[model samples]
Target: MPEQGKKNTLIVIVGPTAIGKTALAVALAQHFSTEIISADSRQFFREMEIGTAKPSAEELAAAPHHFINSHSVHTLFSTGDFENEVLKLTEELFKVHSNLIMVGGSGLYIDAVCNGLDILPDTDLNIREQLNQQLAEEGIGAIQAQLQAADPEYYAKVDQSNPQRLIRGLEFFLSTGNKFSGYMTNSKKERPFHIVKIGLNTDRTILYERINHRVDLMMQAGLLDEVKGLESYRHLNALKTVGYAELFDYLDGNIQLPDAIALIKQNTRRFAKRQLTWFRRDGQIHWYEPDQLTAVITDLESSLL
Candidate 1:
């Protein structure tokens, strides 16, 4: 018997990329007769199909989903925007179903939905302009080193290759003289629905192998063509992602095709490692092997029933 209020549950499935989160989310959605909200930032764009490792057509057809191709690459969808839209969507969905599932490897997006985002002090536009100028002139290493010296904790978890993130952190420190990591505290907002977090993982060697194999599959499935299609949009923040970025460098004649492909695999593996680092800091999530669907269901049933 569930409590009077707080009966609805948001089942959050999170883990490293290529950890079979989509498969588990679809299965759980089928069992609960519910829908899935994607937190994968890259999958929100229609242009990034193969590179994002989105659910296949069959898997998407298996469950109704939200926020998949819901935005254009040209638009900016910040974490705060995601949190607002998801909260509204969850409120509507709970009227029809008692359980809902949200799945992704993007830790900040997932956290924004579940626990609310940490409110940071306002940053100056001038600082942002300066940081962007520095990035253009001195390259990402300059910004990365600044963040590493100022906020090593966030530096360890953030995507280092993403100049946008590095610049944002540095800008915060410059404007407020506060470490970006210090602003991240447990200032959670109350949600009407209860949340149960689930995580999937395997040994490092196996997970790395899975990431490598997924990259190879993406390449075979015309990931290059997808990048080429978005060549004009390469400067957009959306196109500056893992697989896309490496291929863009290849197209720029800065790297060979084989080297780019290899770098994509290597960078993806590193991204997965950072994802794991970010998720592991949260102690509330229950862990499981990707194949442990039965166990996940049993635990959810016991918690929600």
Candidate 2:
């Protein structure tokens, strides 16, 4: 039997992108009669739909979801903000329900809510201005090199093309004389309730096929049009993401449309691989194939029972 006074457990559905995480999360939430909290970084922005692979209208209507399309592209939000907001929201939800669902591919954001991360010092506006200037002038490679010099270990593991990661790494190294990765200690916090982490995966080939197909679906769903809409904002950090970034190249005539679409699929495959690599390191999570929905729900119910 479950212990008395123990608040409801938080069920986290996490895996690589386009792995049917949102569908699985909605299914689980509907089963448990609870709400969902999105851990996806890009889905928070209202403008990124096709690229982010956000929940469809039917799925959103199937269950109550929070934190999806809640912010604008111009807003400055971080994983830290997500952590704080999710924690508060979960606490409030606990008042009425014992089980809540969170789903996304952003491993860092998921880790933030599951295990509290260190709150770094605020960014100096001047430092940010200087970094932005250097980023634009020197390009992403220069910032990546700077990060490598400061935190070689992190540089090896992080997505080197990501300007936000590179800029933040350099900022922390310059401001505090420490690697940004050093602050990422996965120390578990004392949560008021328990947590059950469920991971969704499949054979590598199957997962890759799913990813390729998903990219195709996104393209058909107006991903190119969406990218064109945000073309002017390509200079922003959010636009530096995979799908949009590659399409921006197409728009700039750097690559043909077909080639750009190919690159999107290729890069998306790579991103999924990285996400799996990140999630695989955690042995505590219960893994399953997306097809094992009923069995997973049964297993989870058994655990909580």
Candidate 3:
């Protein structure tokens, strides 16, 4: 335990997909004799295990984990909801553990927990529905063009292929007549616990190879059948992710299975690139090769001490 006057520490493990964040987090949690909070937004839904690459049952048993497969895909859990729940969980966990581990590749979710999110005004539902319709009819390019015209700053930084993000940006512009990026205060919120961010990375070629292998493994683990089971809920926002979306296209007869699998690998690589781009902007993160477990532990101990 930390000294009575010392604040609890949140050791955050951030990295791209298939980068071994789960194994690292579990190792760190065991080292600290503490628990873990998963900040990976995709893993929150219970139905998404195979595609989301959720920790194995053995891994979950190795260290107590929170937020992994905790919610149903039918539920609409937003980043704001995550922020509130994680803040409460962290406060409660800190009373027992001096150091806690948080691991995920979701940059926005991690940002919400580290620095409070700016509460934008409620967008008009009509505008959101219209944008969604436009996305379905005219495709992502139409929304991308609109966002580029309205909020070039956010457009440049956002994943242009994601309809939800583009819609949100365009909705904010239409509703408030201001760029979505303008609403982001970017101010770090004071937390009761101290935060130490650790980022894992590797050569791009190696990372892409890992992603490809992971996708192949997911297929072997029945990701296609898992996606087929959720066909009824394909329109849900929760299903609008790289793996699921690509598979859905296959099920829709829009692409061949092989092509869909290839697209999954390509899109996942792109998503990893975007995640790195987002994390790179945060200068506080200490970067290390994914396999440098001992060094990460040593650095973390130095911070705690």
Q: What is the C-alpha lDDT of each candidate?
A: 0.90, 0.85, 0.89
The runs of at least 3 residues in candidate 1 whose Cα sits more than 4 Å from the true structure, single-residue gaps closed, are 1-6
Per-residue lDDT tens digits of candidate 2, residues 1-305? 22467658999999987788999998998998889999988899998888988899999999999999999888988878888899899888888887989999888888888888886766666776798899888877788777888898667556555688778778887888777788884467777778899999998898889888988998999999999889788888888888998888888889999999898888888878878878888887999998999999999999987
Clashing pairs in 1: none
Query: Which ranking of candidates, highest TM-score first?
Result: 1, 3, 2
lDDT of 2: 0.85
Report clash pairs, candidate 2: none
For candidate 1, report its TM-score: 0.96
Clashes of 1: 0
Q: How big is the positional error of residue 132 in model 3, measured in Å on the Cα after superposition?
A: 1.9
Best prediction by TM-score:
1
Clashing pairs in 3: none
